[model samples]
Structures are given as structure tokens and as C-alpha cells.
Target: MPSCLTCIARKVKCDAPDSLSDCGNCRRLGEECRRHNPVPMVVSRQESKQFTRAGTKRRRSQISCLDCRKHKRKCNGELPCARCIRMKRECEYDTSHGKEGTFHHSYSVQAPVLSSIQTSPSQTSHTSSSAAGYQSGSVNSPYFQSDTSTQDLDPLAMFAKQCPLFPEKELMKSLVQQFFARIAPCRLFGFLHEPTFMMKIDQGYGGRFDEFLLLAAICAAATKVNHEANKQMWESGVEWARYVLQQLILDLNRISVTKLMTLVVLHEHEYRIGNQSSCFLITGLCTRYTHILQLNVEYDNDILCQNSSLTASEKESRRRLMWCCYVMDSFASSGVTHLQLIQENKIEIQLPMSDEHFLFERAIVTDLTPDTIDHRAYLVRLMSIRNRILNYVKRFDKDRDLWDPQSEYHSLLSSLQEWCNIIPENWNLNHTTIYARKSQGLLSPLIELWIFFHLCYLDLYRVVVPGLSPAMRPEIDAVQIAAPTDFLQSSQEACFNHAVKLTRLLEASIQHEKDGPLDDPNIIIGAHEAIRALVSYAKVASSRINDDTKQLLAELVDISVHHLRLTQKRIPTAILGLRRTVSIIKNSGLAYLNYTNLESDSDSDSSQERPGLEEQLNPLSQFSVAARGLSERHGKGTSSARVGSECSSSQKSMFDDDNLLSPGRDMFPTSLEGWLTSNQFGDFI
Candidate 1:
């Protein structure tokens, strides 16, 4: 292969060096040169020569056009390569024939037709036009388009179409189906560390643009993984992802929330484990994301190179971005952590270039004046996510309440609030800047609720009942530091209010739709099904845990899943239904974990060797210990501080809850601040 320039000027076959820069022909041409691919890449010259030399030489070459035939080149072998033949360029295609008509061979190809090579369109280029997705605009581009419209039915009208919400039991069943369905096992998730690679890494993977899509996918996957943890540094996770995206938006010289979440899910995928190329790609993406987000506005260099339509530097920047997408998607559920990389002795990876772009037109598109149904649907999704968070917090609640401030549930609590926080608090969703705003009320909450279910899967809590735990005293002791009152309390209250309101609105909208028949099958689905499902939630909220409510819940979930499966719908709605199912499945897992905790540990060694506090203080543990702790708080007149001793902080402990010491029954905590709060437990979230 030769540089286009070298292959053009020469009257003979231009065997340019296997390097992008300073090819052998460039020196002869005496022109400033560059790599045809743009990026510095290695080509195998040795293997090419080996193939050419192994062929026999022709005794006599045929005469051909001066432009096609070069000095010392034998005819019989075609005067030019097959590429020239398709272009209708005049060339000799026949090789020299022997006495009996056997053909003679030649290692060297003849000179190319300069005019044809430079001017004619190659067959490969022509074929791509007919290929869908192969030459797609979005294949290499990051952004998509968005529009603001409110002419459709209110989102709440489609509530019945949403299925699989309420109670952990139903949620777990659906979760397993969603994750395992239509996906390859284990291959979907794995870990990779570049240092551990056995050979040199291949840097090329199309252009930077391709890398951009892949990188965005990687980031999204990574975020998904962090969300799955039983316990997480939720704020840190959110903040870090936020930090990366903010940086990326600036680097790409654009900002959109849709791309942000998209990247988060991408980067956290499980498929990338043990994948060297994938890791390198994400590092590149981080660079671009950081460049755009961190650089001062004045110093921002929109231009990186001038010759090409896209600046070379900017092209590379897109590559990094795409690489990020790739890494995210490859790593989600990969079970590979930074720490694991060290343990596995893998290499650190970096991104080459993807030559991709940042596009997030859909999430950013917003409108004003969303209908009543739309608003209600948004409330539904938000509430659903909030409940999912409550489910996680409930695992550590010790009490069977919706959420506990000091418990690990707060991690999910904060994340849920933050995710929903992206939605603007306005009646109209289309014009709002938040994710919920642009989603046309119905879609926003539904999709978010799916994310909520995914997050629950991360927490390994098995508790079906938290009240059984003795850690929650009949009354709170003074020693335990209560969770912050302002955050979770306010969040939960707001969530409940919004959920109830949304449910009612969905009911009204569905009834309104049932009033008339429509062409779309989903329209039929829009009728009362959503309302009936909502009513089931009301039953549970009111503590009407009778068979009727449970049956209603099952019905709601069933209806929603059925509609989603049957209807031709968009990704957001599809995502919601799938998530509801996943939640159903995940709830089952939690029940198992909880039941295990409630049961006795069969082996004394297992009990003594509990690796973490979660196992040790589980509901099955002796209540006397907590009772004694409660009694001890009565002995100590003064209250324990929320912060643990300096020594304790430095040492690794199973699960430190010094903040959770009891003060006494006399100073029992009723509400969060007034009564029980984990003392030594620093931010519970």
C-alpha cells in the first residue's frame, strides 16, 4: 500500500514504505506528506513482499498503455491492479502464456493509471451507500435530534402500559429476565487490564468517530456497575460521573443530559473485562471529556488542525470520547474493579483515537405545557425509582420502614434523588432542561424506574422483613447517630406525594382514553389498565397487605408487562417495562438474602469468619447483643458523638457502626434527629 500522493504521481506501481509518514515515494515526490489514515499506524511490509516474491516471474510482459505500464514491468500479468480494472481504465489483464498456453507469473504489479486512481470512485466506496448502518450518520456521530411536542396523549394515559412495580417479590422475577434474556452469558461482562496483555496492542479500530460511540457506551456501563453495589459511595459515584461528563460536554464543545446517562451506562458494561483494547479506548475518552470540561473557556481550542474538515487534534479528541463509550459498555457487570486489575496483574490502558463526536440532541430536547397525563406519568417513574431506592435502604433499615437515613439505603436514596433531580420541577416537561422534562411525562418516570430496579440488583440485601432485627430497639438509644433529617425525609415525603398524585392522574387519563377507541393497539392498552395497576400501589401504601392488594399488584405488573411486550413502542417505554420485570426478579433475590440472615448460620466457623459486618449483624444474630448495647447506653449518661475515634478510622474493621451505639432508652430516638442515628457511621449514604 502506498500513500495516495505517492501512488498518484508515479508512472509505476508505487510501493510506498509501510509507514504513514515519510513513505519512500514521498521523498521522491519532494512534497510535504501525511498518513492516509490520519493516525500513525503500522503496516506489514515484510509479509507483503513475501507473497510477491513467492510467485514466479513472467518471461515476457504484454504491452499496455504508457500510463498503466511501468519500466521493467512484464506484461501477461495485468498492467494494473484489479482496482484499476473496475474503474474502466485501459490496462493489460493477461499474464504471459507458456508454449502449451500455461500462464506465466509475476511478483510485481504494473504501474497504475494516474488519472483513474486519483479521479475514479472505488467500488468499496460505492457499495457502502447501499448498506444500512454501515454508512449511517450516527455510526460515527454522537448527537441525535430532538423535538418539542405536546400534541400526543398525556403520559399518564399510558400508565397501564407500564408494568412490574411495587414490592420486592415481583421485582426480582422481572430483573432476571431482563439481564439474562437475549444476552450471552459471562461474555456480556468481563475485566481487562492492558498491562496484563501478552502482546503489543492494536491501536486502530476504524476512526476516532467509531471510538467515540464505543467510549460513550463504556462510560454508561461503568456507571451501571457502580450502581449495582450492595453499598456504594453514591455521592462520590454521582460526583465522579458528573465530573467526567461535565468535562466531556466542554471537551466536545457541547452538552446534553441524554448522552451523559448514555455514557454512564456504557462505561460500566461487563463485556470489557479482560479486554485490553477496550480499556485503552476509555482512557482516551476521559482525556477528551476532561479537556472540554476542565479547560477555561478562553483557552478552549476549537481548532486542532486546519487541513482536514475536522481538525486532527479534534478528530483524536472524538476518538477518545468514543473509546470511553466502548469501555463503559464493555465493563458493565464485568465484575472487574480497579482493585481487581491490580490483583490480576493487568496493564493500564489508554485510548488511541476514535475520530468520533458528541451528540445528545434527544435528552436535551424539551417542551413546555406537558398535559396532565404526562405530568402524572413522570411522577410515576420518579416515584417508582424512589421506591426502588427505598427498597435498598430498607435492606439496612433494621426497621421495615420505607428508608433509613443512616443505613446503606441512603446510598441508593441519594442516587435516586440525584437522578430524578435531573428532571425540572415544572408542569410542562418538553421544555424543561432536566431528563424528566424532555421525556413527555410518561416516558421519564418509566425509564427512571427501570434504572431504580437496576440499582436494587446491586445491593445484595435479602431482607423481606427488617423489623425482625433487634438492632432497631423498641425505642432508640441516645448513642446511635440518627440519619440526617433534611435529606431522606424530605426526599421520601416528596416522592410519596408525587407518586400518589401521579397514580391518580394516570387513572384519570386511562379512563379518558377508554372513553374512545383508537387505531394504535397501544391506545387500547392506554385504557384503565394503568389505573387499575396504580390502585394496587395505593393498597400497599395504606398497609392493606391482604390477598386482594397482593393480587392487584400482580395484576398491575402483569398488565404493564403485557402491554409493553405487545405494543410497538419506543426504547424508553421498553426500558421501563423491562426494568419493572427485572425489579420483580431482583426483589426475590433480596428476600433470599434476608431470609438467610434471619435463619441460623449452620457453621460456627462461618459465623466467626464473617468477612463483613453485614453478615455478622444480620437479623439472625443474637438479639441479646443489641439488648446489651441498648442497656449499655442507659449506663453512659453522656451521648456518643457521630464521628468515630481517630484510631478506629485508620484501622480496617468488619463493619464499623460506632455511630450506632445506644445512649439509653430514656433518650430514645423517635424521629431521626430526636432519637436513633448511627453515631460512628460517617455519611450513611
Candidate 2:
């Protein structure tokens, strides 16, 4: 008796009385019982040897078909095996040894062009020796060797095989060139070295999944530039690149410098599409990778001691990547203290060198504190200052250092002033400076740096002006400590001035779109903020101001609105800003009814009723008596120390009264959570 095939396959006991009967296991499973004859154990030596040889030959003749071998299934030694016939797969077999007849299909396989550069035995031995020498101190030795072996496998072939939807090689080369020409010069893509990356593309991608992902990301970013002639090409490129990158991310199992660059590029893409939640999560992942790679510190330091094979350009690229991560975190957090991850004190890497030095692979030692003002380095420094300003504003409710000379507020204001005072003549926004930077491929980043400087000022001063700072509106209205009227007026004035400045810069950037590409979509955020401040001020003061001032404000608002509309075609988030601006203007109850039409109507009767309109629209008019009383109370104090403590209780009661009747509550949010959940900017998550 022998075990039935079903029981054998299931690895269960047959439990049958004899070979003629059905096995209990097969009966329970409701399958047919089939068995093979058992070998006799009492055979002579010659017969046993003959039986063993025949069994060996039978097993050799029953080689599994290719499809069955792939899925680890048993084959029944037929031309088209049972599993293959049942599953309708092509039955093929390896016949290199001339045992099987032949493969069912014949195909010509050509070796890749890069396979000619395969390392010889001597070269391989030398590489192994070099890798061994650095294994004692270098943490990246294994990665370096892995990259070398991957290069030997011909990356271009691997990429083509894995991603069948990739564009042809020539078109891909054009896209790569376009990326470097337009998008790489921006601060977000600064981590990619053009010469090094282009060389890798010309040769091969080293069969590294991360590098393939990086190529897809670059193509995706390049397609975002507005080009009418290649509109179809751009759309297809974006779609294909996005699909390939998503697949690569799912298959990703390790991290490297190229992978980090890929994630940075993807973050920018996500932001452009108004997917801020994805951008936030990606930022967190990038921060973790930065810590894992120890990118915050110099690679050559004792802790890392990178291998000698790492080039100067490679090290500089990693440094630029570290700074880019910090910048991404800063922008994504957008002044929220809890969301921020990168701390300024923990960053020990040096600032990036100038574009010239980086492009030519020049190894220059730029200290942590740069002496010369490189635009990229200056941008990092400004973001560091911005983080401080945002944190200070976030804690404004409980901060007791108002009007103190040594307060963090004063220090941040002084930093902004100093930044403006030290501006280099070369960095001016004239035609000559713009063209010069454009020729050198530095225009976009320089313009972004300039825009961020004004934005920083807006963020710091907009809190005092009602309906300007959405996140801090509740704190502004609920805080008990009464700020000086002079200080308050000055802050409001500063907000208006900076808003105008930022609007003008945005207009210039849009005007110069033909001179060079300015594809950074976050500039729209600046435009939206500028629009809020300008619109708020115009609603309150347009009636009281002279005709010339009124016309100027009208022109600025029109320009800002126009820019926001233009951005909406490329960035989906800009539509939110445009809608909010329209609602604000409509609710103000002024005669400037048409959003598209900003001109005043000469025959409208609203002009005759202008005298009392100011009182109705002014947010601060009802609080005038309380403000004056607080001023008098402070004036009666003999010592400066007594002013803050003595006015606390009275100021609290006054603010409480104002909060109840505040007219700006409709114009602005009353709480942070309410603002985020409101329809205006609620889609951020």
C-alpha cells in the first residue's frame, strides 16, 4: 500500500485499509484517491541498483516547465504541462544542456551598450582592496560597493524593463536638460549637481532604484513649467513620471542621497498640486532620513569618516540636501511651533557654496557662518530668522515682554531691519541685475529670497491689524495687556507698507516670466497674504483717504487679484485665496461691487454718504474710549515697573468688552481651530 497523491500533497496520513480502497483524508476532502506502486524491499543488489538507476532517470526526465517552476508547482512532464494548460500560460523550458527538445519561443537578447565597461578581474580585485581599506572607519563602504556592483548591471536596461511606460531615451534626455535649465536652479532642487547627474544619465543610472526615482521626479518638476508649444508632451510626461515614481516609492527598501533628492522633488510637486497634507508627511519622512544619514553634521567628521571614493561634489550635494530639508520643514510648518521638526541649534553643517563653485565641482570650505552673502545661504539665514518670529507670535497671548527693549520681539524686528540695511547693490531688482542672474541661472532663487524677506515682515506685523492674521486673531482680541496706541498704529502702517512691497515683487516676477522661468508655486501664498492685508486696509481707510491715495490702493488690489487669478491655472490652492478675497470685498458693503472691475462709479450715491462710512467700517472706532482710558491709566504711573502690573485687571475688562462687539469677527476668524475648519482655507489638510 502507498499513500494517495492528495494525502501526500497535503502532508496528511492516508488512513486507508488497503490500496484498493479510498483514503479517509481524500474522502473527507471529497477528492479521488490515487496512488503509485511501492518498491519492494527484498530485492537483490543488482536489481536494487537497476531500480535506483531507473528512478534517477525518470526523475531527470520530469523537469518542471518554466511557468510551473516560477510558481513552485509540480509538473506532469508533458509538452504543455497540466498547470500551464489549465492556466493558459505558454509552456517553455530551458534546453541549454540539450536534454529538453527546445524552448517554445526564440528571442534575440542584445547586451546593453554599457556592458562593455564591465570590470575585469584585476579591476574588481583592486576595488575590493580599496573598499576593504576603508571598512574599518567608514560607515558608507558597503553602500559604495553596492553602487559599483549595481552599475555593472546596466541601469538603463533595468529602468526600461521595470518601467515600460517611460518615454524614449532621446525625449528623456531633453526633459532632463529642460529640468536643469529651468527648475534645478531653484532652492528646492539645489541638491542635484547638474554635471554629476547628467554624466550619470549619459552613462547609466547604476541600476539603483533611487536614481531611477530621481529621474522621474526631475521630469515631473520640469513639466510644470508653462510651455504652450509642448503642452501635450508636458501632460504626458507629468502623468508618466508621476505613475513611475509612485510605483518606485512602494518598492523602496533602502535610503540613499539620491532617494532624499527624489523625496524633496516630490514634496515640491505635492505642494504645487495643493496636497499640503502629503507634503507635511513627506517632510517628516525626510527629517527622519536626514537624522539616519547624519546629514546635519559634516560627513568628513570623526563620526562619519566617509570613504575616499566619495567626491567633493558628492559631499557638497549632501550638504545642500541637508539645508533643503531644513527649508522644507520651515515652509511646511509655516510658523506653527508644534509642527516644526528641525531645530537651528542642532544643525552643524556648513552653508552651501556659490553656484559657480558647486557647478564646476570646486571644493571650497564654506564655514557654518558664511562671510560672503551667497543668495542660497542668505535664504537659509532668513528662514532661521522667520522661525524665531513665528514662534514669538505663536506665544503672544502669555508673553509679558511687550514694549521691552530686550524682548524677543524687539530682537526679531532688529534682525529684519538689519537684513534690509545690508542688502548688496548687486542683489537689487533692476533689469540689469535680473538679466545678469538669469544668464548665470540664479534669477529664480534670488527672487524667491527677496520675496521671503518681505513676507517675514508681513508675518511679524500683521498680528496688530485686524482681519490680517487669521491664526492669531483670537489671541489678538482676547489678550488683556493693552499695547500702546503709537505702537499699534506703527505696526498697522508697517503691515500695509510690506503688503504693498510684496505685491509689487510678485507682479514683477510674473512680468518677467518670459525672461526666465519662475516656477516656484509657493509665491502664491505670499500673494494671498498680501491681498488680505491690502483688502482689509482699503475697506477701512478708502473712504477717509484722498482721491489719489484711494486710486493707488485700488490699483494695488487689482494687481494682486490679477496675479492670484493667473496663478490659479497652475496651482489649485490659489482658487481658495481668490474666493476668500471676493467674499471679503463683497461683505464690506462698499460701492466697489465688481471684483473684476475695481474702478469707482462716478454717478453712485454712495459717495455722498462717505462721511459716516468710516465710522461704520472702522474696526477700532468703538474701542477708542477704552484705549484712551488705558493710555491715561498708564500715564498716571510714576515708575515704568508699575505700568504693566497696575493696568492688567482694567485692560482685561476692556478687551473682554471689545471682544463681544468686535465688527472684525465676521472678517476674520475668532479661533485657530475654527479658522482651519472654515471653508476659506479649510482644504489645507
Candidate 3:
């Protein structure tokens, strides 16, 4: 046995001295020896010539010119094909190949010979006549050229064909009525007028793409809330609406208020269906379009009069549209790193009139009073006030001596109280009998307003009281110490107390299964705020105060979990959000400690008995894991971000009435990052 060539090249001995077989080096390394030649190839001159011709043909196909593919013509097997030479265009062939013999081309980077290509055409003039349109400036004309893709797939035409398949005009009329009765009165956003909308429907708005899309969105959302139509109808409506909007989006220049309204409604529909990311993306576009239309402009009487093209009623609708954008933007950005789009001080327009006057297009407001205004108007005013308060908090420096507890914190509290005091007596929480008729209608907003009112106090006081780590002591050291005169300390207590009360209020509001207040997205966000405030307080308070708050926190958690269980069939994302938020809290270790006996336990016993944060957080962690498993199995997507504590003046609490809580501020999760890093919550998220 002799050594293989590979072994000889490496200067290593190949040992096979015992037998005449493959060498040890070749066998072990699985390398062919080729050291001994067994036979030699023999070919006739004619055979070699035939092989050469076959190789030439194969290489010719591999190196075909680019001009052949673009014009759908055959290449002449030349470097510069006859067609390329005649047309004076570049001809390229991709020759790069990997070890596996796969060709990679960057053909798209080269200049295209034709501006546009027809997918199908008669063979008689495929190439020569196709360029005629580009040369004649037909491509440059303002009139839209018919696109084959869109021409064949008209959503409206499909709807028209399918219209008779579903319930006819009666169903459409019922949906319209239901939208006005429940959805419009809620004033989710100002997209339509009762009179104008009804008139359009009477005149047959089915052919108008913008109006059709809006109607689809309205019907989809209304069906979900009221359940008058079958689920399939709503799903089909959403599908058609999405198709129409996608086609319409190609012409961004043609976007109108109606189109924007259609988008807003679609955003709501997607949100209602628990499509969180898609819903947020739609709102992003909606916000961008709102700015493009300058809906943010606060047109006063003089400005309105100057613009003769806009009627007074039109001006009012614009104002409503602007405020609606503000409200929706505020809601979506809350507790997230996103920035709120619209600002308050920049808007100087009047609040929308009562729904009656606005919907009827009344020319004048002779005897209108504050008490008679729409509930939505109250929401606008409250949001405006919250915007100012948010600005104040953003500029506040904890170390600054100018911080006035009475003037700053108390003033905000008084404003909320004033708002509560001024609403008509029948609107008061105590007058439940008066709300019986419109309980379903009024309860959602009323609970949201109430929760927001409490949350406002919670956010304001949390930052001020028990003060964060580096806060400066108050300047009024000489002010009478306690004996019922220490409003600052009283305000501090109010923060924790409000946190407790807010949770109870939410629990109470959700008792009615159908019209539960927790069904509102903002109200659920309010629950997160309540939970966040309580957790922050527990972490910051002394053992005695922590003991009192622990029970309240536990109660709130039960209330949230129970409420989610009830609404899970309707809004599953709410459950997903709750699970993530709870997991975050559990990982912080605050969720497990029994504050009542924490001080009494001997240090040695406590060390042995108490479980680690991960151990205590297991239930929430397991629940989320199981829920997510189910979601994946069922083809559902959960929210990636969860609501958390204020963390900083820059980052808003989920509880803020408006996402504009920190005006002129861009959020950074300095507090959240530090907290998560310390607790290793990053692994969980």
C-alpha cells in the first residue's frame, strides 16, 4: 500500500502496510487517492467536434442579452444583439454564478428602455408600436390612463353585482339609521352630517367610491356594536372597503375630507376587530391627511367669512374634524413612545355645537347655552384643559423651588371639580334614574369622563407627592404644620386615595355586561393608569401606607381580570394588554409582597420564606404564554406594547385624559428602561 497524493502534499505518512487496500489517510478523510490511474479516455475526431458544438449552444443560451427579455424578442447570440444595435440601447448578460451554478442579476438597476409596458398586446405590433404612446406624450397627460390591473378589478362593480345577494335597500336604510342613532351620537369622530348624509343616501350614493367606503366602514362598526347584521356581512363590508381604499390611495392628490373620514372609520373598524398594528398604521395615514387638509387650522369668524368658498356650517364641520383628529390621536399615542399629532394652543376654533344644531345645519345659535351643548363639546373642552396641564407638567423641574402645590396641583384639581360641578344635575352620577333612558348611550362616555377625571388627579399628584427621589423640599417650612392646615400632605394622600377609588369606579361601571364602561378603549386605558399609579405608590410608600394600598391593588387586579373575562369574546386584545401589563408588574416583585406583614417578619425567616420575583410572577407569565399559544393557533396577533406607569414627566401615564399629557415633549422611556433592565422584564417583553 502506498501513500495518497493528499497525504504526500501535506507531508504526512499514510499507513496501510498490513494489507493491500485503500490507504489509512484516504479512508479516514474520505478522499479519493487518484494516485494510480486505472484507465484513459479515448475519443474520435468526429465525436470531439460534436461535443464542441453542443457546448457552444449551451453557453449561448446562458449568455443571452437583456434586450431580448425586455422587448420579448429573440437574441442573435451576439454581445451587442442586432436589436440593441438598431435601438441604440445597452445589452447586458449576467455572468456571475455561485458554486451551485445559480445566476444572480442586477438587471432592474439598468435604465428601462420602455417607460411602460403593456402586459398583453397583439403580436402584429408588439414592440414597434408600443413605444408610440410614450413618444406622443400620452404618458405625460394629466388625464388618468386606464390601468389594466385596476380596470379588471373594480370593487364597486363587484359590490353592485353582489348587492342583491345581501339584504337590499331595507338593510342599507336600517344600517344608516343605526349609525346615526348609536355611532354618530357617540361622536366618535366628525365624518358626516345627518341631513347631508341622509340626502346623499336618498340620491343613491352607492356609486361614489368615497361615500361607499365610508358607508362600509360605518356599517361594519355599527354591526359590531349593535349586532343587527350577520358577522359575514360586516366582514364582507370591511373587505370591500379595504379594497376600494387601497385603489383610491394611489391618487394621494385627490384625497378629500370624505376620503379622510372614510380612513378614520376604517381605522375604527380595524381597531374594533382587534387589529392593533394595522389600526395604528391607518390612523398614522389619517393624521397625515388631516395635516395636509390643514384641518388643524382654527378658522375663526373673520377667517370663515374671508373664505367665501366655506359656509359657516362647513367651518363648523372642519372644527369638528380637527377636534376628532385630536381626540383619536391622543387616544392611540397614550402610554406608548409615539408622539401626539395635534396641539391644543394652536387650535383656536370654537367647540362643536350641540349634535342637534350641527346635524340639522342650523344657520344660527340664538339661545344656545353651555348646558345645552353636546356631550362631545364637553370632551373637547376637557381635553383642551388637560393639554395645558400636560404642558405645565412637562416644563416642571422637580428641583425648582417655583413648584407651588396649592396653585399648580390644587388648581388642576379645582378645574376638574368645576367641570364636574357645572354639568347638568341629570348628568350627575347620582341621578341614575335620569340616565335610564339613554343609559347605554351615555354610560360609555360618562364612565370614561369620570375615569379620566380621577386619573388626572392621580397623574398630577403621583409626580408631586411622596416626591420622586431628587425632588427639592417645599419652600413653605414655616406654614402651620398639621392641625388641618397641611393641604400639601392632604394632596399627597389624595393621589393614593384616588388610585384606590378609580379602580372601584371602574369595577362598578363594568357591572352591566352589555353596556359596560370597560368596553370603551379609553376606559380600559384608564384601568391601566389606575394600576400604574397604584404600583408606583406601593413601590414609593412607607410600609404602613403600602399595607393599606396592597389590598386595593389586589382588588383592582381582580376587577380587571374579571372584566376582561366578560369582554374577551368581544375584545380579545384588551385581555392581551391586561396580561402584558400585569406580567410587567409581577416581574417588579411589588405584586407578591404582603405589605401588612412585611415589617413584622423576622429578617432570617423572610429570607427563607419569600419567593423570588420570577417565582411570584409565574402565574401571569404562564397565563400570557398560554394565551399567546392560543392566539397563534387561531391566527390572531396581540399587541406588542403594554401600558405602564408614568416612569417620567416626559413619558405619559396610560391614565392621562389625552395623549397630549406632555405637550411640546417627545417621550423617552428612561424610567421604563431602567425599571425593566433592573427587573429583567426585557426577557418577558
Top lDDT prediction, candidate number: 2
Please identify model 1 stretches exceeding 4 Å from their true place.
1-300, 303-552, 560-685
Least well predicted 10-residue stretch by lDDT in candidate 2: 134-143
Candidate 2 structure quality by residue, lDDT tens digits, 1-685: 6787667756788789998999887687666677853444425533442333212112223366677888988886454456655664445554442654332321111123111111111121121211101111101110111112322234455455445356767778888887787776676467777876677567544333344556777777676665344667656655655654554354344556656777788777666655555676788888887888788988775322244465666677788889999988887666655456887799997788777777776676674333433677777878889888876776665666456677677788999888766666677667898778877777777778778898888777655666565432456654324677667666667778888888887778778765443366767667767767776666645555666666676677677777767776555455655665655555556554346544322322221222211111111111211222232322233222232235455433332323535765443334667745753321343
* Pairs that clash in candidate 3: none
- Local accuracy of candidate 3 as per-residue lDDT tens digits, 1-685: 6565556655788776644566777677665554643333325432332222212112124345666887778776443445654564434444443564433221111113212211111112222111101000001112222233422333334234423232344676777676665555454564466676666556444233344445656666565552222666656656655554553454354556766776777766666656665655676787887777777764444543454455555666677777787777665543222345665566665667766666655544322255446567777767655654544444334323323555564576678878777666554555473256245466666666667677667656644554221112232221224213355456556676887777776776666545545445445555656665666566545454645456766777667555555554555556654654454355446645332311111221221122222111112222222332344321111121112221333332433445535586434335767755664223333
**Which should have the higher TM-score, number 2 or number 3?**
2
- Candidate 1 structure quality by residue, lDDT tens digits, 519-585: 1221222222232223323332444345664454444444444443433121122332233333333
Q: Give each model a TM-score.
A: 0.28, 0.64, 0.56
Model 1 RMSD in Å is 22.0
Task: In candidate 2, list every pair of residues with a backbone clash.
Answer: none
For residue 192, model 1's alpha carbon misses the true position, in angstroms, by 26
Alpha-carbon lDDT, every model: 0.29, 0.59, 0.50
